[model samples]
Target: MALMITDECINCDVCEPECPNSAISQGAEIYEIDPNLCTECVGHYDEPQCQQVCPVDCIPHNPDMKETKEELYQKYMIISAA
Candidate 1:
């Protein structure tokens, strides 16, 4: 599943750099995670870097965008293939 940032974010910008896929970005007020770019670090790291560092713990799975590990890996592969 792709991780999402809730309104709890402080716009601290901490999670942005932590994302290996460069999935996280600054929105008008809070940060946003791009589903196409988010692999939950499947190809880059052992875990979701953003979730690991977010102080507010606002990063969590998007139930609507849920996917299994294989799907996540395929998504990562698709991006890397490009």
Candidate 2:
């Protein structure tokens, strides 16, 4: 599944750089995760880097954008190829 930044985000700007796919970006308010670009670090790291470095613990799996590990890997492959 992709990940999402909740309203609890402190906007510390740490999670943006941690995303391997560059999915995290500054939104109108708190940071936002692009589901299209988010692979949850399936092909880059064992764990989501943003979640690991996020001091506020605002990042969470996006239930609305549910995806299997295989799906995430496929997405990662596409992203990597491009």
Off by over 4 Å in 1: none
- lDDT per prediction? 0.91, 0.96
lDDT of 2 by residue, 1-82 (tens): 9999999999999999999899999999999999999999999999999999999899999989989999999999999999
lDDT of 1 at 56: 87
Please identify model 2 stretches exceeding 4 Å from their true place: none
TM-score of each: 0.95, 0.98
Weakest ten-residue segment in model 1 by summed lDDT: 13-22
lDDT of each residue in 1-82, candidate 1, tens digit only: 9889998999998999988788999998999999989999999999899989888899989987989999999999998988
Best by TM-score: 2
CA RMSD of all predictions: 0.8, 0.5
Query: How far off is model 2, as Cα RMSD?
Result: 0.5
